[model samples]
Target: MSVIAVLALDGVPGPQLSAPGLAFATAARHHHPVAYEVRICAGPGFRSTGGPAPFGIDTPWGLEGLDDADTVLLPGHEGFRAVPPPGVVDALRGVVERGGRVGAVGTGTFTLAATGLLDGRRAATSRRHTRELARSYPRIDVDPEGSAVADGPFHSAAGVLGGVDLCLHLITQDHGEVVAIETERQLFLHLHAEAEDTGGTTSGAGPTSGAGREAAHSALADADREAAHGALAEAAYNAVTPPGSSLEPVTRWMEANLHRPLTLDDIAGRAGLGVRSLTRRFRAETGLTPLQYLLRTRLQSAQRLLERTDDPVERIAARTGLGTPANLRHHFQRSTGTSPTTYRTAFRAVVSGMTWPERPDGRP
Candidate 1:
């Protein structure tokens, strides 16, 4: 079972902390035996606004509690500055270096960014703070339209209420779509409005933050412009699939070995199938050739890093096994049809509701 620790700080809105805990608890209770152990780790002095009614709970652990966790969650708080407490920042950095999943809820993203773990990563916090976040962390790509954004092991949300969406996403990632969807149904979120909407403005289309959420939504529309408007309905449907970890052994192996430069022969030998048979089965199951799937998978990881972290292009290339920054630029352009810098800028502007100059049209 995973040990999930939520880092609680003073000033966090009551719902921001409770939402994820409640959602994760619901997910844990589905089985006869729970799949995770969850706790709240209090940082600094334990005090919360709104008194005992909303912020009444006491924490069982302290900052040191994160050391024993497989995942660490930071809930949203108000009054964040360009800099956060050194202890809080340092603790979060350690958690990520250890390869533990570290997530932030709503304005909690400010704390995560202060840790420097998300320096260049794409992330979102409460829409109310999007401008300040972008101004403070110019390198980080802030996605407004994204209710919740996941990059590598770091997850972030745009509002306190969005914590529910973030939990659902993680549940879907850890388990399967069927399990997550069932959980959502029980929670009365019968559909993921963003995933199901055509015009992108369905009933639940805008976030609870209203104008702030709308700004982010506008950015999302621009980011997805190439999809031919409402044509995205079909594509979004196709994009929804079971979690990657639950697939067959060979597929799981591919996911595990992504950091290595692998060939068809390497995968086939491990899967105990001939090259031809493996190719046939893979195509039948995933509808893509082995090489195509590998490329897509690698690109997906690269995109997440581009969105979530400040790692240099060279480092991202090496980690994703594309060989060099040049290789990354080449393939990234071909796949996404935009340079990483432009992608980041567009995303930030949308989330911040700012306008940027047009790209050079090669005029004399």
Candidate 2:
């Protein structure tokens, strides 16, 4: 298990302090292999009985608590304009020196910037502070439009709810794309407050603050969007297979490792079969050759990322094992008879109840 220490300086923003633990727990719940010991550390004189975890720490660990942490998170606070205490800055730097990551959210970027760790690095902070942060730290590159920025081991979030995006990015780095999607789905299901006054006009990340990029919305109801999500996910990675199928294990493994350059022999080695037999059996069961299925899987992954995320095509291509943007575009246009951008736009409309036009050959 890894340790994630959240150091709360004086005047800690309540939401920023709590969001990381929430995102971590939700990720763990969705994917059992992910486990983290979250420590909510605070400055001296901090004490709590019922804190984030069930067994609250009687004396919240101070900067010393970060010594064993794999990731030390800092939340924005009231005194963000003032430089962090010397001890706090030293503790944060120590975590980086030992090769751990450090993340800050909202105005917390200001606090981290003061440590000089952000010098010559790009950072994201609250929109209002973008100019000030740039002016204050002349060496740092402040991204005014980005929701999150990761430079080396340092990550920073721009808006208050950008914490969700930052945490999701970390989860993706630690686990994989599929796990991050599942965790985002879990968070979406648990988000309750829609709108009390406007009959549901919530407006965080397309009306779901916890949605991040995976659960980004269409013009559908929550249930409908979830159904669409399930359908897409099932098609992309989890087509139904009969019990005791010979290729079940290999197919599951293929879905998990779509980002890898998998050939028939490599997959056959995993399934303990010869190349010919693996190809013959997989094609018989799935109606596509082993290589064909692999390409299809990669394209599906690309499509999911394109539709549900704000990530650039180049990043999506890399994540989906399409290798490069040019390669992804080549395969995507050939397979769908439309460019990736066109597919994303048309499919989102389809999910919103718009019927897709028939193909040139009159096929659906």
Candidate 3:
């Protein structure tokens, strides 16, 4: 099993600390053999900054837990822009030095960057903070548009829901697609329903409908959430499509021919291989069958059109080969957790130099 140590610091956001645990636990619930052992560790004086109420939180482990961890996760906290607590940076550095993977969600990227491990590395943070992160850490290649980024063993995610994307990504890295997809279903459906029953909401909406589902989805339409979903989509694509893979030509062809109704035989013919052989090779190379990759590419293309142009959803869907507006909305919401209209609104606001309302947390 992979041992994951989550570093809880003073003023750490509660969701960031718990999302990974929930993801790993969901994986354990669905998988035959448990895949992860998650430990929440903290130095002394740890307190949660945002919750129903201000409260103290204590963990069973301390900084020492990181020493034996296979992965260490840092969740965004109130003090992200401030210097980290003593020993925090060193412990994070030690995890990477000892061959353990390290990742950050949202503003937690600021904490990881403080350790200097991100120097000369491409990292990501909340889109709103990208400029600040770039200015603060000149050595790090901060991707403002990235939802999640993985450079070797270092991973970073942007926004609040980004923790889910990050953890799901880590699960995907550790296990194959089948296990990760099952885990996601459990986490977003069963576990989310249970959470809603208790009058609580998960950081991101689950896949199923339940109490507060509409409200949660509404909340996810903000600028931060839109960025998070885009980043997640990008990260998922990157995870499957590595550099210089054999599937590159096929994928490029799919992108280029998205306006046409594509069939497996059509793809196979283009690749000069039998259908079965093409299917096997495509799955091996991209973790998805050719059809799945084509669908995702179509959705991504529609999203770009939504963001960049005033095209109607029907037109965008037809242009991306999705066939109809209703089909586009169905797949778009299922994949991105938001509607095309809502996504376009948020994206357009940013592009038009319009300022967003202050977040509930009061950050700009």
How many times do residue backbones clash in model 1?
9
lDDT per residue (tens digit) for residues 187-295 in model 3:
4433321111111111222322454334323422332243354544322432234445677677677777776666677788999999899978865665555666666
Off by over 4 Å in 2: 44-59, 159-162, 193-249, 252-364
> Over the stretch 1-364, how does candidate 1's per-residue lDDT look in tens digits?
8888887777767766666666776665432123677787777754773334655567668889999788888877655663665488778878888988888877788888877788778998878878888998888899876567888889987754537777777776776554454344334322122121111111122221456445433433332342333232212121112344223676656655665656667767887888788767655544444555555555655655555556666676666655455556655565555555555444433322211122242100
- In angstroms, the error of model 2 at 184 is 1.4
**Over 4 Å off in model 1, which ranges?**
31-34, 50-54, 160-162, 189-364
The better candidate by TM-score, 1 or 3, is 3
What candidate 3 gets wrong by more than 4 Å, as runs, is 159-162, 191-364
Give per-residue CA lDDT, model 2, range 1-364, as digits (tens).
Answer: 8898988776665666678888888776444346778888875433332223322244358788999999988877767898686688888889999999998888889989999999989998888889998999899999987576889999987744537777877777787655565455445434532221211111212212343323322212232333343433223321222345688788778777765555566778999998789867865555444665566566756766655566667677666666556667766664445566665554544332312233352212
Candidate with more favorable, higher TM-score: 1 or 2:
2
* lDDT of candidates 1 onward, in order: 0.60, 0.65, 0.68
